[model samples]
Target: MSRRTLSILALSVICATPTLYAQEAGRIQAGQFDIIPSFESSMAYVGNVAYARDNDPKIYSWRAIFSPELIAATQVDGNPVQFGYRLERGVYFSSTPDDYTDHFLEASGEFELNSRHRVNALAQYEDGHEDRGTGFHWA
Candidate 1:
């Protein structure tokens, strides 16, 4: 084929390529409820496991973390409401006594009595432990 014919064929093929779009695949609906679930995991090597300030022992260890979350939302009586739960777990290879897990729970609601007035409320609960020397922290 001639050079001009080859150029036209290449141009036509490029213009005819299809376009693609991406959509969220993690959302699910069940009986007036919207549920979304997600998870995250990580692993790291720590040269010093102890969060010491002075000349404390510098313990080397490997840490692994895993976190999972679930969210559910819906409309109740013309009001928007949502609930969520999350769990975080940590494991230490050398620092076995420092291994810990945490839990968090939360809920929120929004109400509109009229066009001129609105009300909202949120509640949260957390159960966890802080690092050494930081004192105990919980809510």
Candidate 2:
């Protein structure tokens, strides 16, 4: 196809695509805190499975991932306090050895100090792993 025709086709395809918008979290009311629970699942294709040079053999794989998250927030003495947790699990149908599960934890709090200054604190932790070709490795 000519360059001009290809460009026009690409432009038309882009213009025909639908727009996507983020929806606000639907919060659930608990006894004292508001909770937000969500789940996400996706599939991905990896062009290279191993950290190999172009001269070496290349491997490709596909994987599916599922994640669930929950967040809870409340006010303690009019100060905001929150806690959150999320877990992600990956399943590789062809490359089982590359599958992994990850856990995430978070906590945050805000304290009002007098009428002027306030203190905010946050802590987060994640137990996750890097893909085969990602991150640093010791020689």
Each prediction's whole-model lDDT (CA): 0.75, 0.77
Tell me the tens digit of each residue's lDDT in model 2 across 1-139.
9864575455445434543222355788899999888777666677677766659887776666667789898999999999999998876645667879999999999999899999999999999998786678676
Q: Give the Å error, residue 101, model 2.
A: 0.3
Model 2 stretches astray by more than 4 angstroms: 1-26, 135-139
Looking at model 2, the pairs that clash are none
lDDT of 2 at 124: 100
Q: Give a tens-digit lDDT track for model 1, residues 1-139.
A: 9864575455345334442222256678878988878676666687776665577777787676667788888999989999999898877766877778999999999999999999999999999877654575464
- Estimate the Cα RMSD of every predicted model relative to the unseen true structure: 16.1, 9.8
Residues forming the 10-long window of minimal summed lDDT in candidate 2:
14-23
**TM-score (C-alpha) between model 1 and the true structure:** 0.72
Query: TM-score for all predictions?
Result: 0.72, 0.73
In terms of TM-score, how similar is model 2 to the real structure? Answer: 0.73
The true-versus-predicted C-alpha distance at residue 6 of model 1, in Å, is 58
